[model samples]
Target: MEAATLFPARAIRLRRDATIRAGQGGPVIALADASLQLPGLPSRICALLESLACRDVPEADVQQDLAADGMPGLLRWQALVTKLDSAGLIERSVLTPQGPVARLRQAAVGRGPGSAVRAPAQVKLSRFTAIRAAGGKLVAERPGGHAHVELETAVTGVLAALAGWTSAGDGVAGLSPQLSRAVIDLFAGAGLLAPGSPDDDTEYTDAALAQWSQADLWLHATSRGTRLTSGYGGSYPLAGRFPPLPAVRPALPGPRVELPRPDLEVTAKADPPLTEVLETRRSIRAHDPAAPITLGQLGELLYRSARIRRVFPCADGQEAADRPYPAGGAAHELEIYPLITRCEGAPPGLWHYAAADHALEHVADPGPATAALVMGARAASIMAADPQVVLIVTARFGRVMWKYNAIGYSLVLKHVGVLYQTIYLVAAAMGLAVCGLGGGDAADFAAASGLAYHAEGSVGELVIGTPASESASESGGNR
Candidate 1:
């Protein structure tokens, strides 16, 4: 298409009527030969007049049809039409049968049976060059966007999940994982997954879909602290506000290590039934094997508290990531690593929760003291035995800093709060006792995880099992 010219005369010959062209007379006149020159006429007006000469149709239908063409505001079309009328090139009349109509006569040449003569084509001229300046290329015609109904539905699901609906135990995404996945895939395919640059060059990088999924984890984690008189807890407060503590051993045990392979299945169903165990759940600092928690029970708890709920395809349409929890701006920076000790359902070893697969991958067997060591100075007194398992919530600063600028730290703080709380509530609902440990030795935790000590990821600890009496009191009986 040619660049739009100002006031170009646009002529239209109605396919159903005779051809219309501009005549030489100052006023539009019927033409025998298509040659005309109007005196004292503005060059800009000629462009619009010519555009009107190209098509043949009722002036009312033609004008109304042109008005419906783009995303432009109505005020703009009204102003342009008024300019043409004032220039005397076009006139409007209310015909008894046709209602209101706009037409051109004289200098315009077209033959039709109707007594009323209309502009052959509607000529639209932009009065201000600024109005023609477009933000970007006009979007391509989207054919079969009808099938994109699925995509629309998926986008809706993602938006709903982001809005806290999924975290509320709504089960919309959980029950329809495929739908959620489809939504992300559609967005990626549609080029809607661009990771726009962040304000802070040093902090947040970009808002990619992977980061979005990670943000989901943070959101779901923090959703547990739903009821609050003040914004003291919940995902919002923790966004980059609290730095992660290093992993350290409790006085009673050696420095924390990745534990040994547990006897439980990573995804197995534990005995005493998850439902029953949840009912009997309590914070017991000590565990009695006589209570022998089965493999399936362990898997159920892990899935409920930390499993990946959905994966979103990136803008490139080639990569994908998981969002086990909802995130704000999709800035995910936390990694959940488990320190398993006595769970019958899982091997007594270190494992990473793969949100993508909703499965656990073994990291190491740090031995029996692993739990005690992770709790560090925060552990129960020496008389108290280690709990069944400890979950280490690690933060990867780079993950967040990429999308959010330096202010991305705010997002990280929110991340920690959300993930930790989700662990708390889901555990509580399952009848498992959980505690959000304060400070830990951050340096030691990184060394154990075999990942760098960079700000991209850090440790947030949650010890689960029968909560000990003293530990329960330390929580101010909040359980």
Candidate 2:
């Protein structure tokens, strides 16, 4: 009998139409249409179909699991179920005992292509297992064990007396020739003694251990011996220093001092000749306020300095890599914000320039610092006082940290140096002035931008407009 017979007609009419939205703040497509619109989505839908085909799903249970999966925000599940029903991929009937039941057939199981491939698994070695495999092996030793004792107490006295003895026919010398050979064999077996150079004389002498340092003798004893009357030889004591000195310690570090922010003002001088501007570019710390730069000039600086040049697929297709400034690993983590106080043809306000779009996103209109900006940027105050523009270069540490982990901080700092210099050179080449700044209140600046302070911390700042004084060039030249 048909399952529909289990429920009254009224129950069938009570079903509600469900819809799903995909992507945020845009034209949301129907769940069924989305599969056709996106290249790989049909495969995902097929995987979901395969999962359902393996189970006996009741109509209500199907909806519950879909909701629980939390994919609706990205893929509207309820709406997709409705589309599946309309397409005859699934049929629902009233199972009197179970209320509403969904009976999925073979037709639904073969609906779409296969899903995205799974990632390969990684194998790792455990620390304990690795260490247990290595029974015992000394790594290395630190210095300074001997108390200035230059001779080996273990065998030094025996070797010393053997020296200063002369031999006669058939008469034994101070050190028995047999004893010297025995000590050499014993020490060599223990790894403390090694055969001397080929040119070394076989005859025993007082200076047999002359080359050995105090630390070396402590490890193994040296030998002194002479042939007796059966052979015939003599030995003597050499001058010696009783004790050796210890190694010196490294010196202490210098006191720390608060560093000044990067200088950001362009000096007041003829916009250095155009040819010179190209050849001898300088990071100007003063600017020409009388000749305020225009919005076009600002755009040029942003693009030549850091605009995204190209984007391509990274190792995994999950995320893309964008190339803006040259990064060691194409980790373009630095970002820019323009604090526009004065720019011709641009509003006198603050803006966040999206590198991807090369368009400005209006953030807030900080009327004017009417008062001095914190940190005594007198020039910035003069900019606020006389009105000028400041550009901030910030970094999202997480973007870099994702790949480099511990050393990402170093890479980020180096990136800042390259980017700031680019701006400095570009500003000079364009007949404009720029000062790389470092002293603005980061927290306040972050608050004004409405982004997480940590996500976009101010790494450096630049001021571009005009110089503060006319005699600045003469002062700079003298210095």
Candidate 3:
């Protein structure tokens, strides 16, 4: 609740979020979100953990308890401490008979307790480190951090003033003597601070790291490579609390229009050869206004490019599905919303593709937000006029998030790209134009559809129509 003023007082306690559950033989330490079993607990370890749970116990008293135990308590208590420290279950404080120097907690999961500062002449926060507010508290973290530290309200100003490399003697915050060591050690251990020495030439020159921005590296690390491995993948942490989202989003309610499904055998002979489609694939930007795309063409494109082909049951009564395009874990999260501006037969509006039934549901009338989307895609592709159809691709995040952890959003992005290629190739084969835009405004899409941003929002965009010319020039990989 308060900034740490000193190196945490040298006392030991369980973290507030951590609870000790006594089992028949396996004693489990359950954090707010997870419970795990670990080794090296003394027979009476639960009693000690119970005491630590209620209040911080002085280090000397703990040693005394162990010493007073059946046998002089070096090995047993040491084992428990080792297990707790490795699992980040213990909150340690540095005490001086009268009071604690600073109460500190290691909030990083899976990362070992941080190393000591080891006196240095000069230190500076790492260039990659970031301090920001999260869940009502200021957290200090570095990209791919091995440790995480919380800052005291006072420490904010302390770290701010010490932004540039500074002497170790300067002392952080200056609120307490222990503040400097604690701050230095916390940041240093998290890879949030580097020594003033010029030994980081390799770090700077690293080709792998050099290509990454701080945010990209953070996402990559947190989603795949970070040291925070406790819940990195699905352990179904919310299994009992929440039900998994259905495999396919139920079709949106709307002014529905049934679409024609082309006979596969007829389409097979009607389409160009695979090699011809691959060689002629183009990112066509401008639509042929004179010969605007027809509803029939649009329906055929949706059917061939995205319609679900099969469904099979999965665990927990959930079902796995097959579509023209592949998805991670059979989680077909991509949904297509076509904004029709110059289509024949279909009125100008925002329509969602009902892949399961091969139909379109008019969800909203085209308006300012839709115009903005079209214009944005035009600008992104440098088109002279809006394409006949702008297909906004969105993901039902819960579909992947419920089944996958850490890499859920990343997998959705991969699906977006895969589906884009699917549409591109299919459109090429159909003798129609399609171009995947580089990016889109998720907020604008949410405004247009009246959809919750987090539940389902645009991740990618594709412009489709009859090409202005048989050959379309490439821009931003429309090729």
lDDT for every model? 0.42, 0.42, 0.74
Model 1 lDDT per residue over 379-477, tens place:
532225565677777766645444444245566667778887667655665456566665566676656666667753555666776443444434333
How big is the positional error of residue 402 in model 1, measured in Å on the Cα after superposition? 0.8
The sequence of per-residue lDDT tens digits that candidate 3 reaches over residues 60-119 is 677767775655466777667776766767665444434544344664655475433344
Model 1 regions more than 4 Å off: 1-289, 314-324, 367-372, 375-383, 467-479
The most accurate candidate by TM-score is: 3
Misplaced by over 4 Å in model 3 are: 1-114, 117-120, 130-137, 151-157, 194-211, 471-479
Native RMSD of candidate 1 (Å): 22.6
Of candidate 2, the 10-residue stretch with the lowest lDDT total is: 124-133
- Residue 366 error for model 2, in Å? 1.2
After superposition of all CA atoms, the RMSD between model 2 and the true structure is 34.2
Worst-scoring 10-residue span by lDDT in model 1: 124-133
The true-versus-predicted C-alpha distance at residue 191 of model 2, in Å, is 32
